[model samples]
Target: MALSTNRSPQDTLKIAQVRSANVDGTWAIANKAGIAYSHDPVLGVSVVSKSDWGRLAEELSSSEFKMVKIDSVAASYGALQVWSVQTPRFDNARAQRRHSGLGAIWAVYSDEKSSVPDIQDFTEPVDAVYTWVDSSDPDWQTSYSQFKNSVPAAGSHPTSRDIARYTSRDELKYSLRSLEMNMPWIRQIYLVTAGQTPKWLDTSNTKIKVIDHAEIFESPEDCLPTFNSHAIETQISRISGLSEHFIYVNDDIFFGRPMSPNVFFTGSGSVKYSLAKAHYAEASNPRLAVNLAAKLNAELIEAKYGKTTARKFKHVAHPQRRSIHKLINKAFSAEVQETAKHKFRHVNDVSVPSALAHYVAAAEGVGVPADIDYAYVDLGGNHLPMNLYRLVRGRGMQMFCLNEVASVSENEKRGQLAKRVLDDLFPYKSSFEK
Candidate 1:
């Protein structure tokens, strides 16, 4: 049979290896055809001779395997075409390159060694940090109600206290599943919460650590019962044992396909920040909490560097550095402290990891702009059903976010629809789950 198109790039490579091994064992192509090659998990195979490459291609096609030419290169020795062998399940599947580097399917060579230059892969350890809260928990709700009631209604943004923002439709469970399936290279995961853990999560997983709010906050007494995500995100760098390079993820964001560490970090360990086309500086609603935070961040950037921050960042996993965050804390000490002390989302707060840190890192020359195939699905929007359908059927995005802007009257209906889509997207249980 042919390789399934739905399989991930890593799984496709494994299947290719198995098929190659079978051809070597049964046909004895290496001995009869006189070919020398080496193979690895990253780069599939390297063929040294052109005649042997022709023979191998013939054997693979004759054995009922499908092959498509993905990329080609011309060298002084000869012309080479990279072949990816997989059954195309969709009309446009042939156009898609499964991996970032050379074909995971197979590649022919004209020289003694691989002519393709390495893609600057790094070996540094990377971690993931997620800020989550279980709003349904009695103790958490008690604190949330107490603090939420204390805030005055006159000056707060309309959607700042929206309950839809805190409602968890078990997105974290599937998000972790997506991470485990696609980004297996992550070294560790720190789940920051308000003294509540999901019942389905397996705390025994060594790769995951459940962090409490009191543990990371500089002043636990001041920030302990806070429901503000901005306040909590300000303390993410304070997570004990966090890696030098880490990705800050919100529970609503999910990895859609196989991803490499290079997607988030460069070979030299510089962070790659995904920028959106929307400019926060030109935003119409400055009264919105998120917009106000972006405007505040732009002010800081402009005051320090004299250059205006225009574009906003995508709503995906934010790649960050601990040292850079420390630098930001030192540079904007008062702003950082002010954000941390706010019990609720205030107009004066700055989005630290998502917005401010990216700008500061860019100014210091440690961060570079990158592009990702990202999708943002707003749950409160009218096209929720269509968006979810497209997200699942396409399966081409690198990352996606299911964001709820405000608490609608039909919260239960929308929650059910979103959960159904998530379950369809990821039905298999991850190791982090019991």
Candidate 2:
């Protein structure tokens, strides 16, 4: 059978299993060898044996499949060694496993007789929060225009108020689809909006809740009709019944593949945040609101801990702690209030969850810098076609973001392409959708 080049990692693993079952009968070989094995979602089947692995390895290596060794680090858990079974073409998608006594215990083993928790496993309830706006709504557009005219044109970032920033291509729908497909462990999803809900969204779904700005902000009268994302983000932690641990995601960000809780949090409930190589201190466009917020965040960190923060966090799903947000809100009451007061993106605004919260959490020794398999595609970039092609062909990324930084006319043209790409990536509708 010829597999499509754009197959997901799970698809690759399934293909490997079918070939193995056909070439080497599953029970005949394993039962004769007297080896115990279990099924792993990511690594296919994991066989644990007290005897030497030489015979099993040789028996599995055939013309259809090849066995390769993998060395992986389990962050705080130490080193992990596993042998992977892969096809020649789909080498990136492999079924792998190590001995029973290997470094860290796999999830497949954690369920069995071993009741001890793995150092990498995080069992706490983690929710997902998304801040979204629909610029096409007549009421929203009227409010946006009113706020845009109210603010002075000088000193404000060009793209801060750009319609591209608020444009919706049904990206939120696909993002939720990706979440349900890839990260099923999420306990609940809160869609924070400006009193507008997606028409296609299934509000009756118990897993999802729609939260208006009035519900989260302390002073809804002053902050309502706000077009500023920074302002909205500052009060996300105020959501009623929000979990202690949560991930803040933008409407354009997506989960590309299956992920474990360990990717965001440690066994001890500490956050693992991904940092980008880009730093605000070296920003080419310091006037941009995002970079300016980073610079302001650096200053705040410097003032609080005597340590300077220069690097920016990645545009992926940010792991956030409600307690940390409350801490920042109290510690920097003036700054946080100032941010909330902005009716639109202003020069004085500071990003809370995206940038500031990570730095503050790190300074308090609860957030650790980490790495992720991520990709960022600029919707307005010249190489958009190539970037999206690579994204689809290599369906191995953990997370990705499709950001539009173009003008209204430019975004209108690019929006179609983005929708097509999203539709191709996520064809199935999630329960959150109608």
- Give the winner by TM-score: 1
Q: What would the TM-score be for candidate 2 when compared with the true structure?
A: 0.78
Model 2 steric clash pairs:
none
| Each candidate's clash count | 0, 0
lDDT of 2 by residue, 76-123 (tens): 122233443434443333222211111112222212343233566677
**Model 1 global lDDT (CA atoms, 0 to 1):** 0.72
Return the lDDT, model 1, position 64: 47
Candidate 2 stretches greater than 4 Å from native:
1-116, 152-155, 411-413
Per-residue alpha-carbon lDDT of candidate 1 for residues 1-434, written as tens digits (9 for 90 to 100): 23344855333433223334433442354456555655433323343446567777776556544555543321112225555443233213433333211123345666565544444654578999999989888887777787688867554556667766788888999789777645666889999998888998889989999999999999988767787899999999999999999999999998765566777887787889999888776777767787899989988888889998888889999999899899888888899898888777888888999989898988998899998889999888887889988876773467899988776546678878888777656545677877
Assess each prediction's global lDDT (C-alpha) against the native.
0.72, 0.71
| Residue 175, model 2, lDDT | 88
Supply candidate 2's per-residue lDDT for 400: 91
Cα RMSDs, all models: 6.1, 6.7
As a whole number from 0 to 100, the lDDT of residue 424 in candidate 2 is: 61
Local error of candidate 1 at residue 39 (angstroms)? 7.4
